[model samples]
Target: METRQCGPIGRPRGFDADEALERALLVFWEHGYEGASLSSLTTAMGISTTSMYAAFGNKEQLFRKALERYTEGPGAHLAEALREPTALAVATAILTGTVRSTTRPAHPHGCMGVQGALVASDSGREVRDLLVAWRDNSYSCVHERFRRAVDDGDLPQEADPGLLARYVTTLAFGIAVQAASGVGRDELQEMADAALRNWPLT
Candidate 1:
């Protein structure tokens, strides 16, 4: 049996390697790395084992590619939410959006990265590191927004940007977990709103 090759990260030449990666990503996202068996991946990817190995290198590499794809997809939106004019506004939007997005009827599996980390034993060091990096990056993005808000006078200069950023991310993470655990939209929105109202005003 011939192995199928995964195409380039963005654009492939002849075959839709990128598309295959996306399919594989969805399977992993819904099932988690451990739950997504090699057979399942091949079936989902529509490629044989040889091709899967040739294109993705290994299960680990495919998982990494899926993470990359997620960053390019969902992470882009999250980053955009951090750009709101007011820090509090941006924070609220992000928090609410996260809960809404996670709890949407179509996406019931929660965050792929968060699931990967919480399950723990299934992923390797690299996968864990990638999740950590994403979390750290998210906090930094929020922190930068807070710093900008302070400069723009929306927030007080005395507010600790780092702590504020961490808080925003922490709230977002809590929402993700809650959404995963079947939290309702109305209730989640209330929690998100209260969190925004508590933002340091000084």
Candidate 2:
């Protein structure tokens, strides 16, 4: 006897994964990782818990994917900023980009990577650690770029790449926090500009 071929699996995932992921990213952006409940996430994604799990594994896994989307979307400026011709330009671009990304109208305020996991409970430890690594990787990239600037004489011989990187990253983070706290984009941009006025801080 010959067996009949089955059409496929369950319901055809009646939603757009890309669009759903974007919705999830906004929820995570608006609320910290721990703060975004399954209900909220699924509601925002316009899916059920079963659909979320079936499509993205679990909450943490969904969060991981959302973070990836954040990096590629709003957080893409860091990579582009690193390509600026001079160290000062790099610093400027990073800060400017941070301010803009964290304060866009019709979008969640603040950096997701910064606000997503600032504090975590016992169960959220893994997510907290993941964000730490995300931030550390960003710092490392900036440090390396600044180091190259020092070697190229773009920065003075006395300039310290590590210190400079820390300074810029710190300002970037500060801008994010301020943006989250209702700080205006213009004011933050002015502050960022002043902070870089005396660049290559000896």
Candidate 3:
């Protein structure tokens, strides 16, 4: 009888790639990129280091995919906010969304993209830069949205879209930091409401 060769061993039983990525995302959200060690990630993903490597390439690549998932999942508010009928509404949605997302009861208490790479070591420099670029892209999108608002006469001719976008994003990032510091959602929402009472800040 000819000996039959066994096929390559498959992923460990009960492996769910999406669920694994979600778990990894939570780990990174709580621990940041550099702080999330390979051991921790694999453990959270419920897989061996070898399995992690085969599925996600490496730690850095896993982080990239986690960030992408975060953008589409928890960080989707920005895209949705941009579609509001007016710039003020868009800003409101953005701030409200930031407050809610950063303070969710069962999730990490901060924005992953904000806290993911605030300060990375030499090995984490690429991730740090990646976050910077990610944040800049968000700013650009808001700036362009506000510019369109100006063109549509939704904002005053003197309204500076760049400045407005900066103001909003800065506030949103600040809210994330505050949430991470244990600030309550109600208080943040109140503050956000107060801040936007006079929209298109001069």
Arrange candidates, best TM-score first. Answer: 2, 3, 1
On TM-score, the leading prediction is 2
lDDT score for candidate 3 against the true structure: 0.94
Tens-digit lDDT track of model 2 for 116-164 = 9988999999999999999999999999999999999999888999999
**RMSD in Å for all candidates:** 5.9, 3.0, 4.2
Clashes of each: 4, 0, 0
Query: Per-candidate TM vs. native?
Result: 0.84, 0.94, 0.93
Q: Better model by TM-score, 2 or 3?
A: 2
Better of 1 and 3 by lDDT: 3
Please give the lDDT score for candidate 2. 0.95
lDDT of each: 0.78, 0.95, 0.94
Error of 2 at 123 (Å): 0.6
Candidate 3 residues lying further than 4 Å off, grouped into runs, are: 1-14
Put down candidate 1 lDDT per residue, 98-117, tens digits, no spaces.
Answer: 87766778654467767655
In candidate 2, the residue pairs with backbone N, CA or C atoms under 3 Å apart (3 or more residues apart, or in different chains) clash, namely: none
The residue ranges of model 2 lying beyond 4 angstroms of the native Cα positions read: 1-11
lDDT per residue, candidate 3, 125-198, as tens digits? Answer: 99999999999999999999999999999999999999999999999999999999999999999999999998
